[model samples]
Target: MLKGILEGCVLKVIFDNETYGYEISQKLQEHGFQGISEGTIYPLLLRMEKNGLIEATYKASVLGPRRKYFTITGKGKGELEDFLTVYKEMERAVHHLFAQRKPEADSEENTGFGEPEWEG
Candidate 1:
């Protein structure tokens, strides 16, 4: 679930502007996606590049080596649209499901899955 969502998010970021992996990670963090390291971002970018959802080009930076920037392709925009549609449906369904729960259910200290909450 997260992989797919992350793909959409990466696509959206690239669609908004051509950017590199590190900048994408920073934008995600600024958007409330904390703790997502560049390690996680590079793999996703590689996969997106392989799938032709995005294309990368090396550009000379003011400091250090060249940076590989990403831009979304037409296919990627379509995928982002589809992802948004499906995400909205799922969000509504989850909200409705929780809203229908019995009021007594809220008093329990369970994990909300018919089991005790783990103390991890």
Candidate 2:
């Protein structure tokens, strides 16, 4: 489940800018996705590459070895669009569910299902 979400996020990151795996992890962390390590991102990148969602090119790195930079393919762009559509729908449903539940929970507390209301 989370992997699917991460896949969409990684594709978006790549689509926005062609970058390497480590840099992708850093960007995600900067965007509030903490604890996303390169270890996790590498396999996802490999899978996206194999699935034809993204393509990689090797570029010389000033640091040391060549780095593999990723770019989104046509298919990847389409997938990202689909993912955003579904994600937005789910997000709305989740918000609606919680909004509806909050009133119910408050009413239950006032009704004294468990702890009694203070009233003092």
Candidate 1 per-residue lDDT, tens place, 8-51, comes to 89889999999999999999999999888889889999998999
lDDT of 2: 0.90
Question: In candidate 2, how many Å is residue 35 off?
Answer: 0.5
The lDDT values for all models are: 0.88, 0.90
- The runs of at least 3 residues in candidate 1 whose Cα sits more than 4 Å from the true structure, single-residue gaps closed, are 106-120
Query: What is candidate 2's lDDT per residue for 1-120, written digit by digit as tens?
Result: 689899999999999999999999999999999899999899999999999999999999997999999999999999999999999998899777655644435666543243436853
Best-fitting candidate, scored by lDDT: 2
- Alpha-carbon deviation at 106 in model 1, angstroms: 7.7
Per-candidate RMSD, Å: 3.5, 5.2
Give the worst 10-residue stretch by lDDT in candidate 2.
108-117
